[model samples]
Target: MKNQEIAKILYEIADLLEIEGVEFKPRAYRKAAQNIESLSVDIEELYKKGQLEKIPGVGKSIAEKIKEYLETGKVRKLEELREKIPVDIESLSAVEGLGPKMIKVLYEKLGVKNLDDLERVAKQRRIRRLKGFGEKLEKKILEGIEIARQRQHRFLLGFVLPEANAIMEELKPYVEKISLAGSIRRRKETIGDVDILAVSSQPEKVMDIFTSMKRVEKVLAKGITKSSVRLHGGIQVDLRIVGKESFGSALQYFTGSKEHNIEVRKIAIKLGYKLNEYGLFKGFERIAGRDEKEVYKALGMQWIPPELRENRGEVEAALNKSLPKIVEYDEVKGDLQMHTKWSDGANTIEEMVIEAKKLGHKFIAITDHVGSLKIAGGMDEEKVMEQAKEIEKLRERFDDIYIFHGIEANIMKDGSLDVSNSLLKQVDVVLASVHSAFRMEEKDDSPRNKSDRK
Candidate 1:
């Protein structure tokens, strides 16, 4: 079948699955459509070669449909589905909590095939007074219609992150692996959030957790094709499920800032290759790449880190193979400054050490505010010495880590260190900083002549 024809079929299937309340299945079709759309290969050639299955998310059933499309001009299954459903699929699908099955019911029983008809029924109090739906459900459905119309264009990221994390955590017990992608993963800070890609042997249970998140907010859209909700913080989150094989590609595609992927595409084009969210494509074929590394290696480039992927210089660097070594979390060996309850911090000297140990740190200095500022509960010399004694005691408890007694000594107006040399020498580290002198004039720090000070 032509790609558009397949896309239409997939869209219909997705709609039906949503109305039918089958979670994850809709994502399979959507992913299929996405994969096919991103292909650089001639669809006709792939169909003839029976290589459609090589595409992520295109399983045996979809492949057969493609073959049938190649043999004939139209898809029988799609035609049958179209005939079975009313012409106003989009309108009927807009009603919240109503999917294909509900659509069928609305069409057959109520003669309602669109939002206008559904709204009229709702206003007439007919649906509210129906067997299963009450006044509350009808109100919810009406609210859903408004939301569907207003947010029909874009998603917001501020809302999507928490819902994604909650769903991922819920599915953790059932699946060994799951990841959130789309704008949220891109660290866009604000997002038109996309679906959470979860992989598991027990996909049914994983999908159940997704629908279960409905209680946290309200289910705005639900289908076997896709499920979306307005989470507690007014965030709309979508969750997609695919087999383990498709997880890598789907995650990459969904998590993309399209501009960055366009850069990847440029690289692919230069190297006589094609790249998409699914995997690296080489002239109508999927190259073997189960992960992002493989995808880049297939394109003859180093792995492109996510942070450097604002589409700025990524493509140029990739082609030249001169990408800078971006810092990773593991490379941080020490925290230069932190606080303790001896000053105004949350933890005590002992408790802070425990916290640092949990983070796998080698050393941490308790640079408490001392004497200069009253707001931070700055300590005097006696209190600093008392804190030092506590630190010495805690030192015996930990042999693998170093705990330093230090102070964030204030910088005076003349650019001099606040603490005297006697106290400064007693500590393992010193971090002199200006807490209140932010407006001070810049100073040149070459050794001044003693005669100038006099």
Candidate 2:
């Protein structure tokens, strides 16, 4: 938790530095932030051991900032930056059409410090009067703000999953059984909140532990069987404690894509068993409730993985015993695509390989971002060749794993590859992806003809 907090401060410092047009330091700060966030162990533990600089990207300068934050609950540099700028860079950056440069301009020219100020300026037609921001840009800004407003609070699972796992780990010793429920368990792309289910004899004690955790920013509610707290990052997590007999059913009940649960309940009704969070019952006689598989078995279907429970064909497939054999976590052997410090990834190529090896991956690829995605720290042809040398050295040291050297080249707005065909021939693999000019019309999404290019 302290790791994430310190990393957030570093990231904000980087953003503030960029807005101030500082040279070189913003990228350095961002790199340090990435390394901090990627650390497998607690940064505070490292601090206690006086080994903060042991982290990949933490140099003497960045290490000092981390120390200040850990010792004082805040960094003085970031506080100074915030006071000087007095603008909410992080929140404003979320608004489309509002990049760092644009944000700086808005702050200086119109005194726009936040999303509301930007909206107010755009609506009043004052933004169009700015030298470069014409009526077209102003119109787009309004639309982007509306879109951002509707979806501002939703967080990507990649960012929230670690926190969820950490919280569960903390409560493991106190609860009889515990699990992450809701869309988080379903592996949904965007999560509005986190739901945790547990079987605990001491419900009140568990709730107290949950609401009192250091990562918890505020305890929204406290109850004997249920409680909710807003984490430091603004994700509200709800804890539900049920009877041991209801543990499995409660998990199934809360780990839903709503529509999926409704379909399962319908199947239970047809099978002459009533189903709910408590258990599957026949005329009030509890039958299957202690295990999730038993509930599915009573409904005459396979137990679907939470990720596949989206009310798709999974229902019918489960019933017919044709449910696809999803790859077990251990069954996976290779990681085909990943980034390193060459791009926006937090770790170096060797560090990534070492961690992947720990995860039992037999093979992996170093597909760092390249060509035209500078915001992601993309590399050029020269840098790509330089990284290949490092990867080759790593291959010699680690003989057990196959390391595929590759590049995640960006797809241009015209749907053309960013890396030259000549340069592409040098790599073992090439992964193409879209990074810019998104939200284009369907017809423009495909590659254009060579003759159409200017």
Candidate 3:
């Protein structure tokens, strides 16, 4: 059990004590609960080692309760409390900004013991009629309810990527260029949704196609420059169509961390222009004609890379006209880390090599697991040499491709590589990873013992 879990048990115990008319003891438990909730240290571990009394207000009684929860999976006082109340305590407590005392009053007087009942009473305006709840409190509650609904408005990026790609592919014929913009373009691990910018002379045809798309559950809004749709998977897709000349500028605007764009605007002001999603404007006149090249040129700098546009120091760097050349995915000559079926991957080494060749990669590595990962069918030294010989044979057959023989070796204890160095020289690359000892010492500042036990 974690400290938070122990704290929660104590909080409920305090609530039950309050109802039972127990005096300062309940207050003491409540104080201990509050302290434990904020504690960074694990209370259950402390309790095991007889250190729980160190926390202020946590006496012998509370320390015993915490220890009971850790060993027996139940605290006696908490169980008794739950039995007496017979209420959905956690559910009632989840109401925005409402704590235990308020929950007790609501449950005792109005019979509003759960979220659904509370929501119903609030919607009916009866909650404001209760003591300690006035017109202002009711308005805040309704606003909180509205916020809860809005929280569901966004979608996960993993869920949205494929749909966005499908839509972009569908529009490719009509548009001169199509770019996936927004958070997806910026490579956010989780995204609210997707934004796509397209350049098309045939705007009406593009709009018609977009509106008639089968995957779009409903068209939220449609305008000249922009159109938004709620997809079948419950993600919103926003599309903007601009002229071919204005496409780059439009892309820069839509592919924004809004804060980053604000800084971009400030930089544009420092130069002699204004930046917008449409294009760069120069004081009641258009400059750069229609290209984003003109936008960077007007700012007296090389093209600002999108990934660096987080406003940290990119703005200052652009003003000074000094930015490092960022590496692109295409620039990576080979993929060093990957899996194959010789260990645990679904594909064979040859299939992975073929795929790499299709990507026009310079080299491909077939680095499967070695014997510390028995579950992955990790090979021993004999199997390692056999795989190496097989790779050499494949290299001769595939003359056009440079197939690098490699192994993703596991790290053994005593801080050493799994495979012998003589065997290591046969491969072009070595990828080291840990399949064990992860939980004990993988933290940013976790201690590692260097002395060999063996």
Candidate 4:
């Protein structure tokens, strides 16, 4: 709810701080913002309880800022930062692979301040002449800008999921049965819109409540059986009410990959049946409609998981009764790659471990950044050893879960790791990642690149 709004402002503050070359405060703000975004409870409720500081990563200053926002609906510090920077920093940051440091460089070097300015510079080939940027990187920036432009109206699945769930919770009281459908139900990484289907005896009442939702920015249409509204974030949501008899059919039809539906339709026709949103029929007698399983069974196949309904051999697998079993969310035991306060993460080792234990984890790895990635407050050999000893001591206090001491080491441009092999051998796990040189797309077939690629 307000968590996202607060997090966004704090992120902007972080960006401005970075642009102005303020170091530690930006990290602090970013950490606090990240923790706030992941919070399960309402931030306002935490403020009312005077427990804002208790949230991991939030300190006294940040807590006061949160209180200020809840009270005045704005953070004064962010407003002041915006005034000084005088750029639409958020839009510029949305381009892939463009970090705050680079943004600052672009501003200082070419007076580029926004997406349009960056695009103009790239087109003029001026960006390639800048230090640390070449033709390849400049081209990539142009592509990234275009992609960001295309995705402006869409939202990430992770970002939109909580809001969609909240909306579903609100509508539960009014509908007989409701299900979320569309790309969201299919769990696509980015969603253009949300589709919700419900079964209700009083369709008109359902439509009324859907249109009148507090978060509804505008009602596009309202009808007896269907309604459409735009949410606060420009996300379009469509709600459809269907009879109980057609609920399953409606769900199947709406929760579709167009290709998947075509294949299923072809199968139905081969079996002497006609399928539609209302029902699967054999010469006018309804064979399956009330239950999704019935529809699949009638076509001599097992019901497919929504995620696999992409016409990617799923239909064939279902027909052969050889569909692979997908892992349930609960089956995941632990996270191997996560940060704690030892590096750039907001939470402390104990706090992170405690949260993981609460989630029923059997084990987890504390993979803080190591070596030359100074932006993440990377640890050196001495600090890594110190952290390992601390983790060992912490292990004695908790027997419910196993903790692995690990480091996320940076891979240097020359194909060497930032951390020494001797130090890496001492840890339970090592995660090597590329933090720079994101623009060079062609594999460096040079001997150095070849060895590194290996």
Model number with the top lDDT: 2
RMSD to truth, every model: 22.2, 3.1, 18.5, 4.1
What lDDT does candidate 3 reach at residue 392? Answer: 84
**What's the best-to-worst order under TM-score?**
2, 4, 3, 1
Candidate 2 ranges beyond 4 A from true positions: 20-24, 54-61, 105-111, 342-346, 370-397, 413-422, 436-449
Q: Estimate each model's TM-score.
A: 0.52, 0.87, 0.57, 0.83
lDDT of 3: 0.74
- How many clashing residue pairs, candidate 1? 13
Worst 10 residues of 3 by lDDT: 444-453
Alpha-carbon local distance difference test for all models: 0.70, 0.89, 0.74, 0.88
The better-scoring model by lDDT among 3 and 4 is 4
Tens-digit per-residue lDDT, 1-454, candidate 1: 1454465567777776665577988878877876675454666788778688987779998888777766775678777766666546765566567767756666666778767787888788777666666888777777777766655544445434544675677768877567777767876655665567766776666666676763345777665435677654345678776655556666666667688877777878887876665566778788843676677777777777766667898767876899999766677667869887677665567877887887878998889988677667788788888888988888889977798889878876566776778888888888887776454434433345323663
RMSD of 2: 3.1
Worst 10 residues of 1 by lDDT: 442-451
lDDT (C-alpha) at residue 183 in model 2: 96
Provide the global lDDT of candidate 1 against the true structure: 0.70
Task: Give the alpha carbon lDDT tens digit for every residue of 1-454 in model 4.
Answer: 6788788788889889998999799989988888898887888899999999998779999999999987886788988987777777877888987988888889889989889999999999999999998998898899899887776767899988788898889889888899988889998888989999999888888888889987787999999888999885568999999888888888889989889899999999999999898999999998898877888898999999999999999999999999999988788899899898899877789998898998889899999999999889899999999999989988999988999999999986666788888998999999999997665656653455565463
Residue 359 displacement (Å), model 3: 2.5
Candidates ranked, most accurate by lDDT first: 2, 4, 3, 1
The parts of candidate 4 lying over 4 Å away from their true place are 13-31, 50-89, 96-140, 441-454
- Considering lDDT, which of the candidate structures 2 and 4 is the better prediction for this target? 2
